[model samples]
Target chain A: MNRKVTPAALALAFSTAVTLAASPALAAGDKDKGDKEKCYGVALAGKNDCKAGPGTTCSGSSNRDYQGNAWKYVPKGTCKEIPSPTSPTGKGQLQPFQEKG
Target chain B: MRGGGAGAGLSERLRGAGGLTVEERWAVALLDPEAPTPPDLTSWNGSDPGQRFAVYRNNVVVSLVESLAQTFPVTCELVGEEFFRAMGREFVRARPPRSTLLARYGEGFAEFVDGFPPAASVPYLADMARLEMHCLAALHAADADPAAPQVLEAALREPECLPALRLRLHPSLRCLRSEFAVFSLWDAHRGELEISQVNPLAAECGWILRSGLEVRLLPMCAGDCDFVEALARGNSFGEAAEAAAGDREFDLGRCLATLLRWGMVTSVNGIK
Candidate 1:
């Protein structure tokens, strides 16, 4: 399949593409508002106050075992939004969304 | 959950073993929950420094986990809050940030998810993580101006120079090819489509770039993906076209239209 597209063919295709690309009709996909609205609360995660060190006043606490390897939890987020291939009814049969404890 | 005393014991063991500084020991104890509060640590409240250290340790780990959750919300959403936090906690403990650039933290998380055991059920979770990371990177990538329409129009005048003309894409442009319908899954999350309507097994090539103030995900055929990647690698128009044409479904005109319309082409070079 080494048959190269001739120079004429390449030129024709590229010119046609350039013309089409210039049309405003093709720009309909540009929908994102460029604002942080979607990433609002999420972006705040890393921007926490840069305290000199961890302060005793910062009351965040999570005591779960870090190294323990056990798989009792299953995906129950938007994954539930997808229909399971295994479901006999062809509906979303995944578990209910498990709220944070 | 070993106490601050265990940390002190480990600190002593390390000191006996030799060569560690007080600061290094303090850093290690802060991230490791089982490690005791550093012996040198003192509290202002006159309460036990060990208990205070425990609070500090928890805060440090929680903040890092929170960062991971923020950067990979889709990953968090896919696994649910509890599982994601648990997995994030494990990740935070295993791999702490090396640089103070918190925004760039968790760059390796996608790869980490690929090898993680608990995430094995959602086979596409790793790819989803990768897509999320790419989106964030694109969002923060340096800005560049797209080639003006006149530049491309002028280049079109010299048909013979087409093969030599190289297109420069925007700095934020990122393309990814995934075996899973990762683009669809992301699109589903973005509210463009219902998640249940997507087939997770469908292979897709994702095109991402921050055009103007907005980051956009453009749908691409396999040919378009290969074409853009070639151009991004500095291939000329003819070379990229040839590569793209290898796919039977290649449509050069449509692909070019998409790139130009999205403001992806920053410059058209080597055209005399």
Candidate 2:
């Protein structure tokens, strides 16, 4: 990274990495970025956007990486260009990933 | 298994035989340890489910109280752990968690403290607790990009648009006015001031906010507090300044410089 990623980004990465990466069903509730769509497999564990899953006891509590249900708000056109270590295609996807390994 | 026994019908009547829904039974059972287990819990039974129910009830209430203690650390510190735990026990039983957002756990605790006789000796404690709660809220609010200095300058160049220009303050901003020196007390507890010499009678006014992910609690004078409060309450810059005029020689330029310097104003909207 060329610049400081920010504490907020680190926290965001930790939270969005969970269920939002795994399940697409819960991603629709969030309406913060109207022009953005749910980008999966991009948020690192504990970096998911918005609220955590059902067992989320506290704020920003994601403990898993590339969580299928966890998602990030990516510009509508840029999701596929982003890289994901866990995604089968080695890049982010607009919808939830079907992890191969 | 009742062999036409009249007792069977009475017990049945108590457990949904007449009216209580499954959810109601479970909810009622949680509050009253003596109540029979809800019809849905079919896992165990050496005898009456009251013992099992009591165990589950204790765990739930204890966890909720623990949540409160975590949410209001300052409040817990003020009353000591044991006293706060006891108070939390009573608080949970009286007013249970209505929202699932644990981050917002103690929203009503200040109100509860106001009515609690044991805590009445320290009348200002509730307001202090309220301040702490607001601090938590500010820390967790959404991220917003502040309006650049040039943006403010451009808006000011057109004074006629001032009243219509709605300033978008940072999402984490909150103003609080209180009778006690809560900012000092909170600061003292945090090692910013000496707790022993801090006076409780001194009135304090301030706002709590997060600047670039760092939560800050800053004290303000009467005029500045009222000025910001008016704007936060939805008054335009012109209207907010006009409302704040009664607050002892309010200085608009100084207040504007301070607000702009701190990056509190995010985006100025509402002009055609």
Candidate 3:
């Protein structure tokens, strides 16, 4: 009980404690559940069971293994899956790509 | 307790006031807006007026030329570095920066390049500069949401029966079609590709769009290129697409996928 704690050990223990305490709060502060899911959705889509990163959540896209995670501060409607060869087709009408001015 | 009150030395009194003489004030304003114009050259700590003026002049010239260099990289590349620096120096002396933002400093440089005698060998260099400026502007243009694919899908379902369908484009999309392969040249230069392997004669219609955090360049087909040009002119999606599809190579499916992938489509508004 009287053993001395070295400065390095104390620092490491302090950081670990801080991380453990802060993880839940950080997760809760991430407001958009959809974005969190989408950010880690890529991993989910690949059928790999991965823990959601801090401030992110994972959700399933139309593809079973494909998951999407959205970040908290990213505005709504900003996050979309990167178009790959296997991405879905024929859901909506064909529209011309709008060029931003 | 201060005895030398009235004439505590003119220098000390003037120093306290921090006032500048007319000539010094004029020189400082001419050199830099922020510089304090001191009253007399005799009062200056070390440098004489001529020396100070030379330093200021050099700084102003160098800064102006640097701004031009950023605005016209292709023009510089074509002329070679040493020649470009000389040309830039001449340009700075002829026309100084009028605005604080260096980005807008070279609005007239394309015309300047066009008229320069030495640059005559490469007639298309000026056009290349113009195209680069457009790309720069487009890359920094305002951000907008791509139109929801669901809404566009609905519109396409009733293509024949639909009224006006207005399409909103992302703010950062731009296209430039040119007879020369200026796009390819720019691409090679920007991407740091080997210039020897590139064919300057190859023509390309370049489209630029920002997806997520990065800006990308797309090679446009004849019909899609025409369609984007029409949209830029404020044509409705239906109109622009029809004009585009009039070309035999226009494939609706391919265009839609490209648009979606690029995050170029913003909103589809159907007429009430």
Give each model's whole-structure lDDT.
0.70, 0.69, 0.56
Instruction: Give one digit per residue, the lDDT tens place, for model 2 in B53-146.
Output: 6788999888888777766777788889998898888888778778887667777888989999999888787997899888889878998776
Expressed as tens digits, the lDDT of each residue in A3-65 for candidate 2 is 222334322322232223224453322223666766877775544664346655333454466
TM-score of each: 0.76, 0.66, 0.58
Kindly list the per-residue Cα lDDT of model 1 for residues B1-272, writing each as its tens digit: 22335545665644522366566778888888887667656667779888888888999999999888877877888889999999888888788999998777888888888999999999889988888888788877997777887888788888889888889988888888888998888888767999999999998886888865456777678888888888988888888888888788878888887787777888989778
Using DockQ as the yardstick, the better of models 1 and 3 is 1
Model-by-model DockQ, in order: 0.25, 0.02, 0.01
- CA lDDT, candidate 3, residue B141: 76
Tell me the docking grade of candidate 3: incorrect
Ranking by DockQ: 1, 2, 3
Going through the candidates in order, what is the number of backbone clashes in each?
3, 25, 28
**Ranking of candidates on TM-score, top first:** 1, 2, 3
**lDDT tens string, model 3, B1-272?**
12235747754544433365354455445545345544344424765765675566678778778667666777678778888888777666566666776656776677777788988888678778777676566645787876554665455455542324565677888777666777777778866567777777676676777665445667777777776777778775556656676667665445545665566777767633
Indicate the DockQ of the complex predicted as candidate 2: 0.02
Error of 3 at A70 (Å): 25
Angstrom error of the Cα, residue B191, model 3: value is 4.6
How much is B207 displaced in model 2, in angstroms?
0.2
Best by TM-score: 1
Give the lowest summed-lDDT range of ten residues in model 2 chain B. B1-10
